[model samples]
Target: MSEQEFTKSLTYAPGLPKDATFYSGHKKRVTSHAVSEAAENALKERGVAVEDIAEIVFDLQTPFMAGLTMEACVENVRGALAKRELQHAILVGIELDKLAEKKMLSEPLQSLVDQDEGLFGVDETIALGAVSSFGSIAATTFGYLDKVKPKIIGRLDQEKHGKVNTFLDDIVCSIAADASSRLAHRVRDQEERRLPKKR
Candidate 1:
């Protein structure tokens, strides 16, 4: 892709605090919502709608492979996991038929792409954050999950990243899943506070 094309692929998250800081290695904040929002904004800018995206799956059951296509990306990710010999898989779907059919989730996953929705749920947020941290692995994983189901299920293996310990992984997930929700609230709150009617 050209520079413009690449630039168009980036998405920016709204409402980043002016004093907010970014981590260096990304392992800590990889799962954060800010990263996810930025990535989604980038892809949308590139014309890839969040709704159009299939899934965001993470497989640490294998080693990471280089030069992967969308299909290969999953395998490569699995390879990355295998390399670490991690024994778990996490998948988050952005849009899935089953979720829409069961109506288990508050809104169809598509609502995530709707900026007007003002942040509703964690489905898209988590997936977006994981993708931001892990790149296409998260997106394709989500795509794969969407093809199968909507529930963000995975093989629980907390022991894998024990050496690099921190609740940051959990934090990242929370941030991604709820960042937009918080953003919408913050924006609305800011606006509300500024309103003469309320004052």
Candidate 2:
């Protein structure tokens, strides 16, 4: 059915469409490329660029992965964000941060998110959730980046532009961590390919 038709069918149920059992995206699956574009756009809107995240990945992996170019790092960063988990995490975190910026969130909860209280660990938790699929390397790198807040992350966390970046900074860190981990795995694959075949 057409999008308009499907949308009009919402009256079948009080709040949901007639057939909520199916995946809405099945007709036009949300492609990785689409997600990549959206994720990058979201970051760009918030003054963060794909290169900003790529720089972190390069810094984290250059010592271990020789001949690693900035272009390669950037591609890997894009590749990582293409995954639904990273896309969702970054989008959700950024939205929350924007909400806090507008002071649209409720009290107490709003204060916690806006102030970025030291005790508030939910930001890191959301970031870790995005990095979890990448394995121990991403997890550890996320922790390291959280502590250092290198590059754009540092600026984001410290900048006071009426914007609350409690979740955004961590989300960026997780993307870098995940990209670094993906680069590492790709390097491993390249090494295995070069090795002599076992008899």
Model 2: pairs clashing at backbone N, Cα or C within 3 Å? none
- TM-score of predicted structure 2: 0.84
TM-score of each: 0.21, 0.84
lDDT of 2 by residue, 48-90 (tens): 9889999999899989987999999999998888788899898
- Report residue 50 deviation for candidate 2 (angstroms): 0.9
- List candidate 2 segments past 4 Å from native: 1-34
For each candidate, C-alpha RMSD in Å? 21.3, 5.6
Model 1: per-residue lDDT, tens digit, 1-199?
A: 3333322222244566633433333223244344445444533432333222212221221133233234433333333322111111122232332233344446444343222133443444443454453445344444444334332222111223211111122222322222223223344576788978844
Instruction: Compute the lDDT of residue 54 as modeled in candidate 2.
Output: 94
lDDT of 1 at 11: 26
The ten-residue window of minimal lDDT in model 1 covers 82-91
Residue 39 CA displacement from its true place in model 2, Å = 1.8
Specify the highest-TM-score model's number.
Answer: 2
